[model samples]
Target chain A: MKRSICISALISTLVLIGLGTAAAEVVMIAHPSVPVDIVEAGMIRQIYMGQTTPWNDELAIAPVVIKAGPVRNEFLKTYIKKSSAQFSTFWKKAVFSGTGTPPAEQNTESKLIAYVAATPGAIGFIDHDTAAEGVKVLSIE
Target chain B: MTSAHKSTFMAVLAALLLGLAPQIGAQDIAIHGAMSQSFMQTSDNNYLVESEDGSFSIFEMVLNTTANIDAKTRIGAQIYGREFGHLGNNHMLVDWAFGDYRWRNWMGFRAGRIKFSLGLYNTTRDIDMVRNSILMPQSVYTEDFRNVSNAFHGFEIYGSVPVDRLGSFEYHASLGSAEVDEAYFLHDVFIKVLAAGGQIPPSLGFEANLDWAYSGSLYWNTPWEGLKIGGSFVTSDLYAEESFATPTATLDMSLDMDLKKLYVLSAEYMRDRWTFAAEFQRLFVDIVVPDVPVFVPDVGVVLMDIPADDRRGGYYGQATYRASDLLELGIYLSVFHPDWSQRKVGTAETEQKDTALTARFDLTDSWLMKVEYHIIDGTGDLPERLNPDPSQLVKSWSMIAVKSTFYF
Candidate 1:
């Protein structure tokens, strides 16, 4: 009986750790020229919504996003407070109405890093461990 | 341009955008499209199309591309083709094309053919996959006069102002001209109303010129998440003229109408997997006809003026739930008062009530299908020609609409 209980505990721990990894800590990364080291939570939403755009008078803003997946789900739920469907619908309206267009999407974390690192006006989020050189990390306040 | 020319133009433009965006642009350009087909059937009455016996006349295809040129400036356009019964008759047109420049969170400018916002969903009417209902509440969104109310050729200014800890306020205002070149029902309504006022002609046609319109809306996003309240208003002048073949005599007949006032109150609350929305709107119009000679059957020509005022209003409450990963459900109750000033005067002629249920199924990541059922009471706004006689029209009717869309 004791051996069974120990086995159950070990399995539960492993499952919890796996779930945590699926929703790992996300870091807001941007091009080096983006004029911010840290961004407010509300401002991030606005930026993605195309409301708070422009790093300066001369530079335009670009918001990069991830394709549908566990990491994408966790990031949208934590920051945007919207489901993937709702986000897509909102941008669909914008696109069809000629009001706005959705941000570009990168299918993988490495691609997201590479795009943001190379683009001058890109802003995106990725797993903390995946943050690499050439991109600025904006800590959410 | 002619509809054929427009169709070819849009098709070629779409091909170019899809084919050349990669090589021409230095930044990012995204293209998206949706194809939708629908079937609608009504039990006792004909709706948008000849729905009495089931119709497959509803179809739409749209292609759009947006290019983020730099940051503050972006340009986008959509090529839309639709076949709705006898309305569009399979024609492609430019739905909206505009260049947008945002100066800040509180200010942005758009110039071109901009889709004017109405209540909440008007601007997005052409987007099929965004809503679960195959047809929105007809009382609030009459599909017959779609082209006249779809967009305006002008510019608009919109922005959001956020208040610290209190939420935000968004506003949109536009000034533009609107024309009704081929609105079947609107034309029929005028002819019927004129006939009721005692004018008989062999054949008649109507030309409506909406001189200039000003529309504005303000929405308050409360501190509470997923809650918003807003109001919208539109004002315009419509000058209409009549042309007819008298056959026996020359007739001078003309009329003018003004959209004196139009307003709406809207509210919506959305939470996880659930959304509740409601809106109420009213339109006040005044019509004036100068004393004109009318061709009478046997009594010869006579002259009279038919001046009138009309009030129309409607309200609807809706709720939608994302039932699961593959399905969504929605229901709404819509009430319309055709003659708001005499709302309770005539049971069937003055008011209408519609109860609708909708189910949406997601077959795949790119495909969705929706089935909707509606139970309707009263004929408040049904066109007189659809039924042989408006006075003898049935008070109860039902309809079912099924649609599928592939979007990308």
Candidate 2:
């Protein structure tokens, strides 16, 4: 009985570790010229929702997103509190209502990172493990 | 393909693509569209169309283009072709075109054919793929009045205000006028129900006109992530001119109306993969029509005029669940009271209740199919002109609707 219990415990630990690794850690990123280092969790929703005016009243906030991936889904579920389907539906409504446009899309995380680094007013999210040398990592409140 | 469908489809595609397609790769421009063809069948009389024999006369095609010009300015427009039975008649028109400028998070301005925020779903009614159900709730978004209730040519001011931890407030105020065609649904009620029933004189000519329309709404988004409660109010002026010839001379009479006291209370909650929503609406109309002498055939006597004005409105509650990545299911309980004053309650026509069930399947990334069934009780929202036979206008009926859409 003791041997069996120990084996089961080991298996549980391995499974837990695997799940921990499966959930990617995503970070909010922005262009270095954005002039902001930290983003309040509340404001990120508005920025992504296209509700707020341009940041600093000059630099328009351009949101870039990855096409379809776990990182994008995780970020949406965690930050925006919406599923992929809900997010797309929200954008579709905004577009048809003539109120707002959807975010620019990139096919890969690397491409999204590059777009954010190159655009002065761009903001995006990517996996924490990716190299973000030219952009500013925005810490969430 | 029918020329009507083919020409409309090609025209919308051509117009939208010519304007926004070449820049499809641009980061600041966004282009999206959807086209849906629906087949509807009813057990007895027609509903929204001649659905008695499984009619396929319903079509909604739309293309929208939006471009952001810096952070403070953006402009967007939509072109739509909607055919609802014998109306709309395959006309391609700009649904809405507006230039928006936001100076702050708490203030913004919009002009040029702005859409009225009638309720949770009016502005997005023509965009079919955004919702799980094939048709929105008829209580607040009756398709018969969409032409007049859709949008106006004017400007609006809107804003969002955050109140610390209590959540936020979103408000809108708009003023404009609408185009009233002779084919507006109100005329049908005048010519068919009132005149045919001998309440009004047979008219030689009829004219309908609308005046300035105004609307406002305030929403309080609770501290909860996906819960919101709000209300909207809209009012406007309308007039009708009737011309008739007696033995002596031709007389022209007018009726003054105010589409006033239109109110809608709304609530929506989104939790995980489930969505719950409800809305209640009331339309209070005040009319002033002079008593004119007219010969009546039904009563066989000359009598004074009596306007057919009664309070109208409805309420609906819906729940939708995303069962999986590929499928979703939804249910709706919708109720509408065409005559709120109990004037027509004896004929089993006081209210209409619709219990609808829908299932949606995502066939591909850009294609989807939906099937819906409705068990309706009452004839409150039925069009009288379409079903002339009183015996066939059954109190209890059912309908089936199936549609497919493609979007990007």
Candidate 3:
């Protein structure tokens, strides 16, 4: 019984470590030209959902995203309060109804970071460890 | 335009968009389409169309493309084709094409044929996959005047206002005119005339002259997440001409009607995978006829005037629960009355109640199948021509529908 308890404790520790690593993989980013250094979660949601069209400086805001996955799912759940499927359905409704358009989607983290850095008024999310030189990391308030 | 010309036009449009696709950034262009075919079975009383017997006649297809010209400017259009028993008749048409410009978060403008933005579901009613049920609640968004109310050719100004900690407010206002066909417009108008002791020959021909329409809506997003309330109003004018051959003479009749006003109040709450929504609507209609010579078969030509007025309204409440990643369940209760004031003649004041249950299964990311069953009471809104005499309709009936949709 004692050996079993010890093994269980060891397993729980390793599982928590794995979860911690996964949780640390994502962060919000914006083009270097963006003037804001920090953003509220609600503002982020509004921007990504196309509810907030222009930034404070009168420039149109462009939001980019990735295909569905664990990281993308986590980003949506934390910021937009929706699942990937629900998000897609929301945009589908908007597109078909001529109400609005969805954000652009990039294939890879490097490409997404590069696109955000190069495009004016662009914002996106990337892996925390990715090399992002010309982009600004937005601190969530 | 002829079918050949329409096809060529669509082809050329597609080619132009494709050829310019590379010049436009790949990420700025989006092309999507949806197709749905349904089989409907009704016990009796063809509701929206000819479905006396089991019918597999409902089909809808749409192809849409949107391109961002720049951060603040974008252009988009949708080509739609549908055959709903007798409504669309399998004709391909341009649904809407528009260019949008946003100066700031507080203001934007769109010019072209724009979709009519009304209640919560009016805008998205045509997209089957986004809706939980095969058929939307007809109580508020009646299928009878679908074409006339679908969209308008004009311009609109819309914007959103943030309310500090209380959330945001969205508003849309527009003025435009809608294209109408005489046959369908006459079908809807003659229902009341027939009820008013008028007879129309079987081979009736008509022409509709279009007029102006004005519409607007305002919505409030509450501080509490997933809660929203909104209201919308619309008004338009209708005019048409009908001519028929009699034994001794031909009668040309003129019709001028006023869709005096329409309003709807809506509320919705969504949490997790569950959604609850409700809407109440009111519609006022009137017919205006000036001095016109009428030729009756037995009587000589006489100047006659006949005008009618009625108030119609309805309400519905629905809830949906996503049971799993691949399945969803929904239920709705709707009730409608032809005349809210109950001033119209014989049985025209009858009310209809419908309770429906629906289920949708996502077969894949882009494919889905849905089934629904409805228990309906009364025959209030069915076109008079379809049922002829209201007394002949049974008091109760049921309908079942199954549809599959694919989107990309």
Candidate 4:
């Protein structure tokens, strides 16, 4: 009976560890200068779509994006109701027609942060945990 | 003419200049091109004789570059060339050449071949994909006429102002010259009667005429969200000089004809995926033909009478439904009434009406396709040639067209 109990305990412990690792893997990050109020899924979508054209209420909005990847896909699917492929196609049409410009892209989260920091009108998204200096975390609801 | 050869030579020269120019500043030049092919089926019942055909191609290329002349001023130029199959053709031309002095976003001055900022349709009219409908409004911008007779060579002053956090207002005023030559003719035979009338004096031989036209528009966004109002006025003092000779006449005399002035007012309301727009326009023409006599060498002299001035006005309303981000459906109706008192010969003293339904599908990011069908009816006393039977004074026609545009 003791031996069986020990095996059951070990299995439970392993399962707990797995769940902990999964939770820890989530990344959080934001631009250092941005206030917490502006980080929302709708605002992010607006910025990317070129509908929100000002950084502040008084300035024009400039939205930045990262190249398509696993994380980027997850974020867009959850927030923008579109896939990266769809976004690319949409912007391609808009840009060529001179209606609007597409969001600028960087290769990685760090690069996105750097871009948003240097450009005042710029907004960008990164992992939740990477919450680093100079980037603000927009809420994605 | 030598103009064609000269343009070819100029193209070669431009290529050579591009190759030899030094790459020094941050300025860059890029070349872009697009090609599209479409098929159409039409019925003569609408306005003109309609037919069915396939595989027409439209190709265009643009060379664009921008440079900073100084800290406060920047200059840019774009050279464009376009070719249309059998239906129409557009030659190579300078699309834009302008110098910008940007004190700030609120104000600026641009001098060159500036864009006509008259209406929402006018600004992005040249970009095929920017429009939701494949066919633009025939009354505002006719495909055949705009292809050759559109645009101007001149300067413009434009600026924008933000009004207390509600929305911004933008205005542009331009003065320029447009040199255009357009010729159109129709021939029809009625079962019972036959009548025909063309431009009194044929339009030929007279060139180098000067044109003065002006356009201004003001746009305001209301604090009440989702509503925008704008109005534009365009007036042109354009004339063409032509000379015609009768079968027995010797001396070629000059006849001066004037194109009409036009004004347009537009208002739009947008809420999410739904947009409603309406526009009203007035066209005024003072076409005067002087009294002249024709002498036949073998016969005798005949007195030719001239017609009076012509005036026309119309209004159109459109509703667009965005089914999705990539698909749109639109329905529009237009009514036109021409003053027949000004018509010298043929009988067209009535109101003409046109109604159309259109569907647009964005097949891919770079490819767009559109299909439209139009129903046209003519009212009042129709010309004998236009009406085959005396019992009927009205005629109707239907037309169907499909266009596909691809961009690269």
Which is the leading candidate under DockQ?
Answer: 2
Candidate 2 segments whose C-alpha is farther than 4 A from its true place:
A1-22, B1-27, B182-184, B192-194, B197-208, B240-255, B287-293, B296-305, B343-347
How far does residue B271 in candidate 3 sit from its true spot (Å)? 0.7
Off by more than 4 A, model 4: A1-141, B1-33, B45-75, B78-90, B144-149, B181-210, B242-260, B289-308, B340-349, B379-394
User: Model 1: residues >4 Å from true position, as ranges?
Assistant: A1-24, A128-134, B1-26, B194-206, B241-254, B289-299
Give the true-structure RMSD of model 3: 7.0
Candidate 3 residues B1-408, lDDT tens each? Answer: 633354446446754764575587633677899999999888988877667788888999998888777667777778778888776776767677777887677789998778788789887788898878998998888876666677777899999899899989999999998555424535656545544545645535655544788999999998888799999988988777776565557757677878888889999988867889999998887876545556678897677777756578889999997766567789999988878766243353278888999998888879999999999987887876667766778768899999999999
lDDT of each: 0.78, 0.78, 0.78, 0.54
Candidate 1 DockQ vs. native: 0.31
Q: Write the per-residue lDDT of candidate 4 for residues B103-131, one digit (tens) a residue.
A: 54455677755556655566545566655
- What TM-score does model 2 achieve against the real structure? 0.86
Residue B153, candidate 3: C-alpha displacement in angstroms: 1.5
TM-score of chain B of 1: 0.89
1 or 3: which has the higher TM-score? 1
Model 4 chain B poorest ten-residue lDDT run: B185-194
lDDT of 1 by residue, B1-408 (tens): 633564467556645654554575525677789999999998987777778989999999988887776667777778787888866666667777777888778999998767777788889987888887988876777776566567776889999999998899999999997555456545554567556745545445445666688899999989888899999888888776666565566544566768887787999988877889999988888877767556678998687666666688889999997755577789999998878887778688788898999998888878999999999998887875566466657889999999999999
Query: If ranked by TM-score, best first, what sequence of candidates would result?
Result: 1, 2, 3, 4
Q: For model 3, how big is the iRMS in angstroms?
A: 6.5
- lDDT per residue as tens, model 2, A22-88: 4568899999989788998778888888777777876788888888778977888888888777888
First chain TM-score, candidate 3: 0.79
